[model samples]
Target: MRRLMICSFLLVLAATANAAQPIRLGLNYPSTGNYKSEGLELRRGALLAIETLNRQGGVLGRPLELISRNTAAREEKARANIEKFAAEGATMAFGGATSEEAIAAGQRARELGLLFFPTLGYANAITGHDGQRYLFRETNSAWMSARVLGEYLSWHLPNRRYHYVSLDDNWGHSMEQALREATRSRDRARHGFSRISARGARHEEYLAALKKAASSDADVLVIVLLGQDLVQTMRLAHDLKLDQRMQIIVPNLTGSIVEQAGPQVMEHVIGTAAWTWRVPALVKSEQGQAFVDAYIAQHQRYPDSTAASAYAIVQQWAAAANRTGSLHSEKIIKALEDHRYSLLKDEQYWRSFDHQNVQSIYAVRVRSRSEIMQDRFKQDYFNIIHRMDGEAAAPNLDEWQEERGDELSLR
Candidate 1:
């Protein structure tokens, strides 16, 4: 009897050891640079998703473990991180805070034949010009935001002349081009524009750009900047009285920006976001409410757009893998493409043609302190003005691919 008991104990120990081995998922984001706040929120969201999945039996009965690395918004660093993740036996990876880094990582991912999911990068090239079979985007593109917002602005403020001031980067250029194309057909849409490189630019340069936009005859000034640069530009624009002179619009607005810039600075500013915590549709949904509640309960703060997006992406990936009952990249990819999931306020699906997640885009107007205090969502600030359907918002994938056939080729 004693020998039999000892053998049973040894067998149990072996099973426990095998069960303890987790399937690693690599994550690289800008954890220590200018975009650290966004990165931290992303990590929090992804971690929360993993935790939830683990608590619910995990994917394919194997625990999912996150292996994180700080890319500092650098391309080479992101590339190295992907290689390290592959070397460390990570089955799949997610990250890329900036489009440049995301593109670099996508190239490396294809070379390594590793599945890569970009969470927050908005450059069209990731899924357009530089897309690979291994790369899938879980975030909205600059073109989507621009198309939706541009069409709305052209119709709503048809007579209002427009000018643009954007950061001189891949994202900024893509946004500018998208908006331009969307509004070009409208009467009185043409206006002067200025682009400033976010890197190594002097104060005078920023001031000059602001002054140039301020001096333009346009009534609406579209500022295509992100992170600290967006905040800095807003502050200087206020100082130069540019904000007061022209109606300022930010194409890519996030909750963190409103918190960082304060309600006062954001007051009267109009913008569009990929997602916001205050959407009435989201607040009313069962899944969305649970996610918000769990996030606030765990993090002691509301999840921003970045956090929500990252969380959704992780959950989507896990669900797809579980549905397919396989961790193989090809199987997972098949499960994701054309897969419909309801993680947010609206039902979303992965478009097979472009690998872009299709969901509603919100146009928001930042409310003043008085307005926010009186609202039902007292903690939330923005009033969602419009919700654009994802299909209408997305660019024509067929045309886009045909125009850039060679560019989109994996070879």
Candidate 2:
């Protein structure tokens, strides 16, 4: 009888200990799709952060573990992934390589009442009309990118005629609208506009479409494509000698693109990035240098903007959970909203109203091969044109709310 009681007590203790095991962090990214490279980078960044946090004894006496799924960049797949995460007892979830997937994940997050951080989904609606208290965006929105890029364009090439080659999607439309609004006062005339399908279009099709846009008499050609499409467009432009015809402005640029395209193809391209591995201000900072070094040591390549954002998101969430002393959704949300931390360049915080992380936006110009090779930092492939303040770069959500009236539902 004594042995039986002792065994029962020990079993209960073991069960309780097992129940208090590591906190599971869920990630849903398209591991096998058009955005696979970006998704892999996101995973790498998140894993690196988790590894570092665990090495430091993790947060609140609990080590962190990551459980990831492939979303395939599909909305339904994203929703299903979110449900799976919730079912798997994830403390919090983060992912969404594309805006469409992010938006879908955001909607599901609201339904699940789980804390979600969407990394590298630049659509404004993720935090705009589709925003819920459970959803927080860790990437720059279309409006933010447009505002910064527009201001730069107006200042540098004012009164120039412009042509637009945009992707036929919500993100592309949002970017186009924001750019039009931002450059309204400038003496600009739309010389031409072409919308390309983002869903697996042939390279020859894109090349032909771009050739038409490049044939325009505009002083600048704005390419609003992402991922391999952007790479293909730039390469096609180079092949067609479009780069020599007019200034190419890529509103939504990332370090991965610059790396993939190389300095020769990317030379003289002006763009805005939420974050970049080569930003001098970031590289010079102690925290930034540590992140870059750690990322390189782990992955053997410098981290891109998406990777940086993913890592920052995980670190920020861990910090918030640690500070609040709980993984509860409400507590984490409150903690994240109130927290201000410096991960990259300047101090950044999640805006209480919209839950968008207000961080510096880099206006970068891709350097020539010669310039990059001569630079001290191997990743210094960009000439930092300007560091747009986070607050200034972000659109006025209050005004946006006022404009939307009752349509804007954030809760």
Candidate 3:
């Protein structure tokens, strides 16, 4: 409990007059719609963090509290939620299942004088072209995932034809483009493309897309879908026997998604994650392990990357708030920018330029059904194949400058 409460974010929390009061933290997540799995994880993680913090002592001597709003994976809903949070006196709000939603939330939070931390959104634009002073992305970007996954694919698959079934949203666009550039699949004719609706697609829609992919001569099927959408599509792909015909590539993978789709559907699938439940053990992170233990004790299962991200955001933000002894955007931002610490997996840092928390990206492969079933909880899914350091995996200054253009300047 002490390990969980006393994280790297706040080494010492100063006492205050209104210490008995509670500090509200807002969360904008998709509790309904396609990304509900991720949303539940966020809620579970946030609650856990709040419980732990309150158990010992909340940040700045005030109890941390979560005030969440359901975005349902929509940008408009996300924007509205931020407005509500600000009106409700939430000092900070963080959460978003999609990049578009995150961008909307963050922008609105900036206007409302509330800092926004996006926990799961992965578009390059979230921290690049669309970045604002009040927003910080706690997750890895599309470019970071592509950088490592592409390197592995180059050595393993090499010169392969591809087909992309992408979510028609901000995250999907950046992911596909980044992966294409990294893998040298710039030629349109060489690879097939099918854009699926970001909102839950109908059965017929998925059937049409997967059938086209099934007929294509592509050696790999890149799925840029997540949550329930991913579960439904993978089941459809399996029914069509597409999994056996070609290798499947999901840009991002979480234990929640795999558990929903089952081990058989996700078996041998390739992807990347910022942190997995198994990662803490691999990196010898006692704090991370304590988090995992607490989660398992409460939920009777292992926590996924979404949960890990949410917990990190809550703890880190609280720590920063305590460090500056204020919830004002300017002070908290200064405390977090260029902040470095070992959390969850490895040495991760909040970069000043783009406000992205850079960390190691692990290229993972789903274990076989037999192997997965052998586990007591059946959540030991990912086999970490390749680990890329944050410094190398993330985009360089030149790339950031190109994306931000005149909106950014050298310090």
Ranking by TM-score: 3, 2, 1
Q: Compared with the true structure, what per-residue lDDT tens digits does model 1 show for residues 156-224?
A: 877677788888888888887887777672343457778888575667777888888877788888888
- 322, model 2: CA deviation in Å? 1.2
Work out candidate 1's RMSD over C-alphas: 3.1
Alpha-carbon RMSD of each model: 3.1, 2.6, 6.6
Per-residue lDDT over 1-411 for candidate 2, one digit per residue giving the tens place of the 0 to 100 score: 999999999999997796569899999887886777888888999999999999998888778899999987787898899899999989888898777888888788778888889986887777776777888898888888878877887888888777888888878877877777776633334456788896877887788778777667777888888888888889999988888888998987777777777778989899888776655354467777788889988877778888888898899899988888888889988888846877766688898888888888877788887887776545566667877788898868676596456976567
TM-score of 3: 0.94
Candidate 3 stretches with Cα past 4 Å from truth are 1-17, 409-411
Question: Clashing residue pairs in candidate 1, if any?
Answer: none
How many residue pairs clash per model? 0, 0, 0
TM-score for all models, in order of appearance: 0.91, 0.92, 0.94
User: Ranking under lDDT, best-scoring first?
Assistant: 3, 2, 1
Q: Which candidate achieves the best TM-score against the true structure? A: 3
Better candidate by lDDT, 1 or 2: 2
Q: How accurate is candidate 1 locally (lDDT)?
A: 0.80
* lDDT of model 2 at position 244: 89
